[model samples]
Target chain A: AQTVTQSQPEMSVQEAETVTLSCTYDTSENNYYLFWYKQPPSRQMILVIRQEAYKQQNATENRFSVNFQKAAKSFSLKISDSQLGDTAMYFCAFNVGSSNTGKLIFGQGTTLQVKP
Target chain B: GAGVSQSPSNKVTEKGKDVELRCDPISGHTALYWYRQSLGQGLEFLIYFQGNSAPDKSGLPSDRFSAERTGGSVSTLTIQRTQQEDSAVYLCASSLRGLYSYNEQFFGPGTRLTVL
Candidate 1:
């Protein structure tokens, strides 16, 4: 079974600064997918970024990026130029690659607060 | 559908009562999943349904937790004799099928269940 772990239960960043949330997972499979999801007070879960285990290069979105170290089983999310809107609960998830069982296993989640 | 949708955005039920939560997957999406999120916690996989294949219920915590997807579009998760521990946000997600596609799971606004 795959298990994702987010060490930090809460994180805070000053407005316009950067914040990095740490996540690690334990999985026996060599190939898999890692994802970051954000849930605001509205309670809507939205995909933030994703990384494929096979890809050596990290994945970057508009303001979100990931530092994926496959060997270390670490997939961390970095938010640059953080704004108040970035305040939310973020979760890390894991899934096996191209398997018939595509269920996602998620970490406990980290609540991020962007303070002005 | 425009996106995955879950019905009864909030549910409050007494212990030992039965509760049913509904989900409507995005149109054309063949993969649907259910997840549970306890307060201030990460998500836990509950179940997954793909096309007409047998649904995966491995993540279900107990036999009291059962889900069914009808016509491969709408799903209902029922918790019989709900317990206080069953209080959590129920989330639903869907993704496009096919081995070549990126396994991006789009999530819905979850149903918050509060068992008293």
Candidate 2:
């Protein structure tokens, strides 16, 4: 069994500033995929970025990036130049590569507020 | 549509009533997944379907929750004798293949189910 944890319940960042949301996971498998998803007030879940466990380099998607530490079992999402539109709930997810099935285990989530 | 599509944007049903939610995966996608999201919460994996394979029902909360995919394309999640606890948003997603496929999943708008 695998599980994802988001320690931060709520986070706030000034517009144009940077914010980091922490995430950790428990998994027995050596290979897996990590993902960050965003949910806005409209209730649509959107993929922010994704990181492959085998890749030592972090994944970056425009303003969204991830610091993936395989040994520490940590995958944190960093949002740079945060804007009001970035205010939403962020979730960390994990999927075991061995399964060959796209079932993701998600964290409780972190609520981000971008202040103007 | 280019992305996953889900029907019945909103559904309100009395307790004990049955509710059905539908999901249409993107064409050529070999994997589809169902997840539940409570208000202000994270996604809970419910069931996963792969082309012509037995679906993974492990994430389903209870026997009352069931889902099936027809022709490996469109899927339906059925809740029998719905309980108030089932009140939440049901989401659908699809990827090119399973966990190891390296394809990113696209999410649907989701069906908001209110079991009153």
Interface RMSD of each: 2.2, 1.6
Which lDDT tens digits does candidate 2 get at residues A1-116? Answer: 68999999999999999999999999999888899999897777888998889999999999888888888999999999999999999999988888757688899999999999
lDDT for each residue of candidate 2 in B1-116, tens digit (9 for 90 to 100): 57888999999999999999999999998889999999877899898898898888888999999998988889999999999999999999998887454578789999999989
- Per residue, candidate 1 scores C-alpha lDDT tens digits across B71-99 of 98999999999999999999998988724
Report the lDDT of model 1 for residue B24. Answer: 93
* DockQ list for all candidates: 0.59, 0.70
The fnat of each candidate, in order, is 0.52, 0.69
- Writing each residue's lDDT as its tens digit, candidate 1 over A15-101 gives 999999999999899878888999999988888998888999999999999999988999999999999999999999888886786
Q: Which ten contiguous residues of candidate 2 chain B have the minimum total lDDT? A: B97-106
Query: Clash pairs of candidate 2?
Result: A100-B99, A101-B99
Per-prediction TM-score, please?
Answer: 0.96, 0.96
